[model samples]
Target: MKIDATLHYALIFRDMTTEIEASKLVNRLAYEDSLTGIANRTYFIQELENALLEKRSIGVLLLDLNGFKQINDQFGHISGDEVLKTVAMLLTKSFPTPHFAARLGGDEFVVLLDGITRQSQLDESIGFIKTKEKNFSVLLGEQSVPVEFSVGGAYRENGDTIDELLMRADEQMYKEKYKDRPHERNSFN
Candidate 1:
């Protein structure tokens, strides 16, 4: 009887351990960005949904690298990937913990800032990102290449849906891209 009880307890413990491990794996897959180890788009959307449901005011920033395709075409896909990783690192460092950042795929990233109450604070945060310099170098064979991004954002009050917020941010991002084209061309020369 004693041996049976011991075996039963051991089996229960093993089952519990396995359950915990599986839960952790699911959470990791759901939340982590497979490429850069930042949060993924699913995680970002979940958080944004929660914030909106709770009637929270927030700011969403969408960033797309200008001339990213040029880098991929001129250097190669590997170089493009390195530039993306470096940009992700810069974004994670720039934003705070309560604020979430994620790569929305390709060269575009999204940042969601919760509990924002004022336009000035939002402006300050946007200004901070605009001034950040991504100075990382990617090695293509024996050569080093540099890259940068253009960012734009939109603020949400209490009732905006995810699609609406993303659309506004994307539109603003396109405007910034167009505005920077002159300087972008100049920099290549």
Candidate 2:
């Protein structure tokens, strides 16, 4: 009788441990982008909401990879995936704690700057990202492909909603994307 009781308790503990691990995995999956291992859109939205509620100075930087489709078409999806993973690694490394980076699906990414105290800090951060963006390259087999992207950023202002902030950042990104060709700018609006 004593042996049976001990065995039953051990099994119960094992089951509980398994349940805890499974729950952790589910939570991670919900907040994380599977391919890039970075925060996903859901996580980004939650963080942004918290920042808004706390009344912290916030800056959002949106990035869109240039010629992403062409890379996918020419080198196959495996190489494209490698490029994305490389970029994700770079973003996370470049912008560590307090600053958040997420993949907003496809080749689009976003970074949230929290508790920013000055315009200079924001400008410096943007300059660093731009410099990194210009220098980084991904290795695909024997070929090296440069990572090129258009980035736009906006600082939160009084009476600004999340949608408005995102829209403004997106507009700036579009402007950067079409800067060379003035005629194509009208279609973005």
Candidate 3:
């Protein structure tokens, strides 16, 4: 009886340790961004893949900062970093819940919209981003400068990979840039 009790306790301890380790792994993957603190490309891709595999219709918005080179040229790389951070903050605030946002790299950001069953919800989200209040200021020498973004979005369909979806969204973003706008650029500039 004593031997059986000892074995039972040992098994339970091992199981508990395994559970704790698994939990830690998940938390690490979910919370930490591989590149930036916003979110890692893997996390974004996993979320997108889950949504797609679940047959849940969703929207992907890819945003690239136009005139980012101008900011870097005029101010410096530090100012460019400020712009990326500010834009990341804006994206986090804009799509507060139910939407996953991440920085793919450099000046490119992507948003994955889950629980979007209707086209109107997608439209509303797009409109919200379009008219979103972005009042970020950067100190350039002695003066403060402001910046804005031109965004584009695409809906996810069947038979789509992560790259395909992002490319499609990027294409839409570039199309939006082509429209006559003050803050718009020709491409992912």
Candidate 4:
């Protein structure tokens, strides 16, 4: 039997397309958070390392959710899951494209933006983060559980190591977390 070349080519293309879609699905599952649907820690770290290797100017922002444990204890794990999902969506919306946002497990999340060495861009991103308090809450059962987060950010410095940047951001986050202290509010500067 003689095969029609056009039909054979079309069949091959259809099979290729199916394989491509399946591969994409697998990638998403591997790299995405099952609950919040954001990138997982592995993907986030990979991106950060890639940025560092490429010598790109970037800023790393870390956020630690406050009262999350209390909420989980008082409410339920399901409520906590809802809060995480909500916060993930908010970060995704706030830092769309060229900027990366990921859930680094539990209540810790990170946002990476390129060109943060530029003062205007850095200020704008930081301003948006600081002003996002109004959008961080989630509804749990009948009560509204406010999802509060403290943010710490560090810009890439010349010859800075990944660990240093992470530590700086983490330290800033700690200060933010303890902003109730008289001297903690301005510690990041």
Candidate 5:
């Protein structure tokens, strides 16, 4: 059977469109966080590795949300999820293009700042994040739950590998996280 030329082209276009949409959905599912809509850990790691391969000056800002478990306990997971989404929105807004944010599971989130040639730029980014921490709070059922967090950042030094960079940043983050906890400090000390 012969088909009309116009109809044949229209069918081809529709098929192409469907394929494109399916590809997009697959990519999103692979590289995006289901809850917060930010880059998933896999995407973040790949991007970081690419930046390192390109020898770009980059910094990693690691953040851990304080009292997140309490929020999950007191307000429940739904409210906790809302808080995570809000934080992701703020991170995306604060660190636009050339910088990437990812949720490294739970209350841990990270930002990869690329093309950072100066310390001031890193300082500026961290300062903005700290400011956000000061003003950040979520309202749940007439109660304001402050979204407090501890952030630590590490700039890539010469000959630094991904693990080394991540470890340094993680160590700094833990230091910041536990600095306020005297009771727990003795165990580590």
Candidate 6:
């Protein structure tokens, strides 16, 4: 009778541990992007909000791939997914820890760089991206698919909210995304 009671208790503990692990896996899947294996948009926004609440000086970067639709149309989604993964890899390698990158579905990605207390820091990041912007290319069959992107960076203003910072960075990104192509993405039918 004693051994049976002990065995029952051990089974109960095992089941409890399994439940805890399952819950943790579910929580992680909720915030992780399936394709690129980076933080999804929801998680990224939460982190940004947390940073703002902590009053951390941060540089918000919005990156939009230019002509992404064309790439998908020409190379199918496999090539597109490959390009997206490549972009995520570069962002992770470029930023490292504390600084994070997230995918906003489709071809849009966002990066948050903390500890940008000076204008020089922002400028240096801009320079780095400008230098590396042309280096993203993927070999797709016989043709090499070039991954072109436009980046916008904005520093937090006094009493600025996350939405405002995102808007500013997005506007800056659009400026570059539509620099020469006045046709734009939405009305290019």
Q: lDDT scores for all predictions?
A: 0.80, 0.87, 0.75, 0.84, 0.88, 0.85
TM-score on alpha carbons, each prediction:
0.80, 0.87, 0.73, 0.82, 0.87, 0.87
Question: In candidate 1, which residue pairs get closer than 3 Å at backbone N, Cα or C atoms, i.e. clash?
Answer: none
For every candidate structure, what is the RMSD over all alpha carbons to the true structure, in angstroms?
Answer: 5.2, 4.3, 4.9, 5.5, 4.2, 3.9
Task: For residues 29-102, write the lDDT of model 1, one tens digit per residue.
Answer: 88988787788898988988888888788988888887799999998888788888888888898896888789
Off by over 4 Å in 2: 1-15, 117-119, 185-189
Instruction: Identify the runs in model 6 with alpha carbons over 4 angstroms from their true place.
Output: 1-17, 182-188
Give Cα distance to truth, residue 23, candidate 6, Å. Answer: 2.1
Residue 97 in candidate 2, Cα distance off native in Å? 0.3
What local lDDT does model 5 show for residue 26? Answer: 99
Model 3, position 39, has a per-residue lDDT of 82
Candidate 6: lDDT over CA atoms?
0.85
Write candidate 6's Cα lDDT for 6-91 as tens digits: 64333433358888999989988999899999999989989999888888999888898878889889989998898899899888
lDDT of 2 by residue, 1-189 (tens): 268566433343335888899999998999999999999999998988878777789989899999899889989999999999998999999999889899999999999988665667767777889999887888878888888998888778777788987998898888888899878767754
Error of 4 at 85 (Å): 0.4
Taking the tens digit of each residue's C-alpha lDDT, what string does model 3 give over 109-188? 88888766666776777778777635556566677777766677767767877778778777777877667763645336
Cα deviation at 112, candidate 3, in Å, is: 0.9
Residue 80 of model 3, lDDT score: 83
